[model samples]
Target: MYKKSKIALAIGLSVGLATTAGAAETNWRMATPWSGGPWLERDAQMFADHVNDLSGGEIEIEIFPGGTLGSALKVTNSVKSGVADISHNYINYDYGTDPTTALLAGHSSGLTPEEFMMWMYQGGGVELYEEYRRDMFDVVAFPCAILGTEIFLHSNKRVETLEDFQGLRLRTSGAWSELASRLGASTVVMSGGDIYSALERGVIDAAEWGSPEMNRPTGFQEVAQYVIVPGVHQSGGFLECQVNEEVWTGLSEDEQDNLRLAGKLSVFESWLASSYDDLDAYEELVSGENEIVHLDQDFIDTIYEETAKWEDEYAEDNEWFARVLESQRDFKETMSAWPEYRLPIGTMGR
Candidate 1:
């Protein structure tokens, strides 16, 4: 009887250890800033799926969409406090802590979305960003989603020239808010979830979000009749995934490589996905009640000039901003000759 009891006890201990090991494998909780739309939601899901596949199911990331966990602006703090193991975030949202977040988030007017991504991947921007995240926020981050060129504004009133910005109550973020405020627009800071309600209630006259594809699902068109194109404020903005520093350090080197691969894959796939949606949405808006306004070239030039001036002023005061600006500008200059040298093959200058 004693021998039989000992064997059964040993078997129970083995089963308990197996169960605990399985439970320990899934170690991450990735939270999204907003209850994401299809485009954003797809990327998050893809990232999670890739990590799981790469780790052979040894690591699992559970996603919580929306401010379901907390406010978007508080994501950095949430990660720091380990309320979330990781988060899909926009560094620009945390500009209250460091104005340099605008530069890292790629808010400048000069580069195209693709060029901005190149800067991050090849032009030393990623190193600077990683250093900033570590030193300032004590978090680990990567440029996980490339939003590309965003729409300038969805406005209740048509905007054709610089003067149109005057006296309009607009919802904007980062340094663009300062520039817009200088141009006489009253800039209001609000989250994506709050934009429609704000517009519906006459609280804001205009708001700027990502590409039309990304914006259409938000139903901004139902509230605002005019769509401003050629996003001057957010030409090449992208989003980042931030992980708790402790959590990141605990990851295996192979797991780190897989995470980076997932980010790169999402960047390319997101642009491709959003392009189709944007074309379809653009056609629908033009064919329907909303009017698309292409800001005139001369007015666009003025915006470019204003943005240049803003960059200089910000760089002068913030050392972090200055370093990033200098690096991006250098990369931009190096790549300037390529487009001119390569002949346009399809739809060039159209």
Candidate 2:
């Protein structure tokens, strides 16, 4: 009787797999926090297109740009609850789920986006991410978009030194906010959608949204006159696409492979597009109306010093955070050496 039961269970599993295989197509709903901004939004669209093409229309992803379904910050929950099958969103917004998320969600890790991607793809970063995700959230993840280093701060008033940050009300989030608070700035957390009105109403004296390309469409320049370069707070980061675990597991192997490939393609596409967009947007800011301010090197050095201190303290208290942090530090130490000796392409005029 026990052997019969085992055979019956195996047959049931085979039937379920066969039924799933026989399905003609699968439709998925994808949501994003942004209002379909050019960079991230474009990447999402391309990813969807790639999946469709690769799977021969076996998988169709309908994107809901902006917080049309719910608050942007609620994306992870939305996916978990099956309200949306997937989310193309920033991990920093989900740091509440697990503080270790900051390790990937734009900590001041001193690695540029390219370097971070290298660590993620080749140096065990993705494995670390998957371990954390399994513990903290029920979703399958992929790094769908990668951004260049951002313009650090945008202020209504000119800010050039560490002294300028003291008592300043800055709108930010994640690790950067923590670092800024330690540097004597008051940090306020708000959605990117809320920043404009807040800036106009004096709710925040300064903000650090994203790259100039991402910010230009929001009209930050209309209100903030000073634009600080080289985002020391967030050297580089990725926008991830996370799918519900059930939905991800339900897909066939080929379908799963297509999604993975699409995500990787999106990363490469976003990187290339952002380079051009950032260059043009930055030139416009510098030559146009706003006062372009470069942060003092000494002040930046101090910010890094403080960032290191925070990392040490946090790692001591949080094992997961330390695990990811130590791995990245180990990878970056040797990786950084290559760029230092190579051609000065990255340091030509800067």
Candidate 3:
């Protein structure tokens, strides 16, 4: 009888342990807009890996690259609708759903990468983002990656002044396209895959894609001769990770915290890795056949002025845009003291 009782007790304990483990384990699908082999895609994967490690295997996430699950632009919708448990994407991709997202994604003459980080993490930007996503899409969202300044334009025609943009055929998107039009350029919107062919065929005079590291692999140098500097359109940008509201709510508080930490870690690592790679890519571009054209300061100032006017006009009509724009401008003003206090620094290797 004693042996039988001991056996029964052992069986009960094993069953309880199994049940607990089953309840703790969770599997999720993460959809991203980035294709394979780019830092953007790797960053999303890294976040998933970090979540798995941090959660002690309690959670596992699988990454689906761009177009694998659905249209990249609809990733947020996929997550919200449960097609994907989570998604990694740019906030601007949802601009059609809400114009406020354009400002969230970083605009011309907006926050630099460092300032944007400070604004997002410390200056209530994260809370605002969460509020916006929750109300707009019924999802939980946070920035998972921060990218540095992008290349202004890769062109066959030289563009140094505002006058040079006159009648120039440029391929771009979002607010930049509008700005380009305002500057007298005939702007065309096309996918990144189509840029090289368009440039080679003289269908577009110029195009703005990404930073040096991100653009090099696309072989822009082989087709475009001029590499313009200072991407005023997108000085910096944020990639976000969004979770389905139901999935987020189902997680334990500890699991939720782990996901947030994983995102922050991914952001830090990706920023450093991409920034260093961009430096190397820039050096290569300088030595390669493509001519580097630095936009004149006067032209850059004119762009800033026009950007301010564009944002102000949009903000006048959009309450959320106004609020976000106010927050960013306030942060920029508050942090303006640092540049004055510190000694001026030159470009790397200058």
**The candidate that achieves the highest lDDT relative to the unseen native structure:** 3
- lDDT agreement with native, every candidate: 0.77, 0.79, 0.81
Number of clashing pairs per prediction, in order: 2, 0, 0
Q: For residues 1-350, what per-residue lDDT tens digits would candidate 1 score against the true structure?
A: 00112322353244323333443576688877767685346767666655555555556788887676676568888888899998887888888888889887867466777788888888888789888898888998887777767888999989988788789999988788888887788999887888998988889999997777788789999999898988877887678888888888887665666667656666766666766777888788789898889988877887778888888998999888899889988997899897788775346788
- Against the true structure, candidate 2 reaches a TM-score of 0.90
lDDT of 3 by residue, 1-350 (tens): 00112322353344323333555677899888777545445677767766666655566788888787788768887898899999888888887777788778887865788778889899999889989889878999988888788999999999999989899999988888888898789999887888999999999999998888889898888899999998888998788899999999987675676677667777777787778888999999999998999998898898889988888998998888899889988998899898777665455476
Give the TM-score ranking, best first: 3, 2, 1
Give the winner by TM-score. 3
**Model 2 Cα lDDT, one tens digit per residue, 1-350:** 00112322353344433434556887888878877576445777766666665655556788887677677777888888788898788888888766788888777778788888888889998777766776778788878888788878888877889998899899998888888999999999988888999988888999998888888888888888889877888888888888899998887775676567667777777788887888899989989899999989988899989988998998998988899889988997878679567775456767
For model 3, state the Cα shift of residue 84 in Å.
0.6
Q: What TM-score does candidate 1 reach?
A: 0.88
* lDDT score, candidate 1, position 137: 87
Better of 1 and 3 by TM-score: 3
- Candidate 3 stretches with Cα past 4 Å from truth are 1-23, 344-350
